[model samples]
Target: MAESVKAPKTVKVASTAGSAAGSGAAKAASKKKVKGGVINVAVMTLAAGLIATMAIPAYAFNPQGADAAQFKASAIDGMKKAQSQSVEVPETVAASAVARDAASATTEEQLAAAKAAEAARQRAAVSLASYASSYSGPSVSDFLANPPYPNFSLDQVFSVAQQYIGTPYVFGGSTPAGFDCSGYIMFVYAQFGISLPHSVSGQAALGKRISIEDAVPGDVVIMPGHDGFYAGNGNIMDAPDTGRSISIRPIWTSNYYIVRLGI
Candidate 1:
C-alpha cells in the first residue's frame, strides 16, 4: 500500500510538470509570432514610403527648364521690339488737322464780329427811333403857309418864336416839336419867308452886325458856335443843347455880338 501511494504521487507530479512546460512553450511561440508581425509591419511601412517617393514627379524638385527659360526670353524680346518701333503719321493727315484748327478759329472770330455789328445796328436803330419820337408838332411847311407874324420885324419874329418856348433841344431839329440853337432861328425866320441856313456860322453871316448897346429884344445874338434871339438886358431865348428845352436865360459869355436879320 505504501508503494502504491508513492507511485500515484510520482505520476501526479509528472503530469503537473508536463502542463507547466506546455504553457511555457505556447507563451514563447506567441511572443515569436508577435515579434514576426512587428517586423512585417515595419517592412510594409518602408515599402509604402518608397512607393510614395517614387510616385512624385521629378519636375516638382527642379522647376526651371530650358523650354520655360526660352519662352520668358522670347516674351521680353517681343516687348522691347514693340517699344522701340516708331509709328509715323501721314503728311496729309497732319495738314488736315492744322487746317481744321485754323478754320475753327476763323469761324469763331467771324461770329464774334457779326455779333458786334448786329449790336451796333440795334443801337443805331434805337437812337433813330428816339430822334423820330421827339418831333410831333408843326412842320416847316405849315409855318411857311400861315405866317404867324403879319410883318417881318425883329420884335414880330421874336414874338412868333416865343410860341414854341417849350420845344425840346434836338441834335438836328428844325420844326416846332424840337429845335437846336440855329434850327430855332431858321424855323422862326421861315414863317416870314426869310430863308436862312440851319448853321450857326451861316446864319451869323447873313445878318448885319450891330452894337450890343443898340441891340433890341428881336435881334439875333451870335456866339462862337451858337446863336439865339436877343431878349434885351443881356438875356437870350433859344434851344440850348441836348437834354434842355427852349428857354430864356442870361447871356453866359462875353464873346458874342448882336445882329439884325434882313438888314
Candidate 2:
C-alpha cells in the first residue's frame, strides 16, 4: 500500500512540471512577435515620410530660373509703357471747358462796360455841379465866331445873353437877379436897345419866321409856351424852370421852330 501511494505522487509532480515549461515557451514566443510588429511599424512610418517629401511641387523647392526672371521683367516693362500712353479728352468735356472760358470773358467785359458807364455818370454829375448862382463863361463873341454864323451882327445880343447864364429862374422877373424863359430873352435883347415882349407867344409872333436849317446863333427858338436864345446846334441859353437856373444845355422840344429878331 505504501509503495502504490508513492508512485502516484511522483507521476502527478512530473505532469505539473511539464505544464509550467510549455507556458514559459508560449510567453517567449509572444514577446518575439511583439518586437517584430514594432519594427514593421517603424519601417512604414519612414516610408510615408519619404513619400510626403516627394509629393511637394518641384517649383516650390527650387529658385526661379533665368527664363522666368526675364519673362517677369518683360511683362513689367509692357505695363509701364501702357501706363505712359496719353489719354484723349472727350469732345464734350473740351467744349464745356471752352464755354466756361467764354462765359468768364463775357463777365469781365460786362464788368468793364458797367465801370465805364459809372464813370460817365460821375462826369455828368460833376459838370452839373460846377454851376453856381454867379458864374460867367468865355467871351460869347469868340465862341460864336468859331462856326461863322450869318448873324454876326448880333454880337452884342449874344454877349449879353451869355453873361446871364448862371442867373436863377423866376416867374416873370427880368433883371440880373432872376428871369423866366421869355423874361430872360426879353431882358437880354433889351440890353442891346432891342425891343421885345415878356410873353413867349408875343415874341414868337414878332420875329421873322425862318427854317431851323437856316437858323444861326442869337436866333429865337420858339416852342408851345417857351422861347430862348439859340446858342448853337440844338442847345439854348435859357432860364429853364422856376426852381432851376439858366443853362446852356440841349433843347428840350422837337416841335420847336426858329425865328430871327431881324436886328
Candidate 3:
C-alpha cells in the first residue's frame, strides 16, 4: 500500500535556473545607478576648478582689488610720490597786502574831498540868497549894457558864480583855495555841470561866441587882454593873474570876447 512518489529531477533543475536569472538582473541595475552618480560628481569638480582659475588673476590686476586692504595701500603709495615737489608761500605776498592798504587809504581821501566840496556849495547858496534879498537892481541885472546875449541865461551864469563865494583865491589854483583866470573859469563852470577847457582862450569856444553888448548874466565874457564871467552891472568876476584874487572887474574893456555855454 506504500508506493513512494518519485520526484521529477527536471522540475527541480528548472526552478533553480529561474531563481539565478532574477538575482543577476537586480545586481546589473544597481551597478548602472552607481556609475551614473560617479559621472555627475566628476563633472561638478571640473567646473569648479575652471571658475576659480579665471576669477583669481582678474582680481589681482585691477586697481579695485578683491581685498579692501590691498587697494588702500596701493592708492596711498601713488599719492605720496605725486605731492613731493610742492613749494612754500613766498615773501612777495607781504607786498600785495601793503598795496591793498594803500588803495583803501586813497578811497578814504576821495570820500573826504567829496564831503568838503558839498559843504562849500551849501554855504555859497545861503550867502547869495541873503545878498539878493537886499539888492536894489531888477533881480541882479543881466550883464550886457547894450544888447543882452539872448542865448545865455542868467540862471546858468549864477550857477557858475555860486561855486566861488568865500573861497580864497590862489594864484595858479583852480580849486576852492585858489584860482587863476583859466582856473576860475574851469572851476566855476565845472560846478554847474559844464566842463570847460583849462585856459581862458580854450573857454572862449565853449558855447556861442558873442560881443559884450550881446552878453547875458551867465555868458562867459572873454577879453583879448583878460577874461572873466559877466556878473551883470558892467561887472565881471575873474581869478585875475597871479597877484589878484577872484574879484569883480569891468567888462567895458576895449577888446573882449563873449561866449555862451548852453544849447
Which candidate wins on lDDT? 1
Error of 2 at 131 (Å): 20
TM-score of 3: 0.38
lDDT of each: 0.81, 0.73, 0.63
Residue pairs with colliding backbones in model 2 are none
> Per-candidate TM vs. native?
0.49, 0.42, 0.38
Global CA lDDT of candidate 3, please? 0.63
Comparison by TM-score, 2 against 3, better one: 2
Off by over 4 Å in 1: 1-128, 131-138, 145-150
User: In candidate 2, what residue range of length 10 has the lowest lDDT sum?
Assistant: 138-147
Q: 175-194 in candidate 1: lDDT tens per residue?
A: 76567899889988888877
**Runs off by more than 4 Å, candidate 3:** 1-153, 159-166
Q: Which candidate tops TM-score?
A: 1
Better of 1 and 3 by lDDT: 1
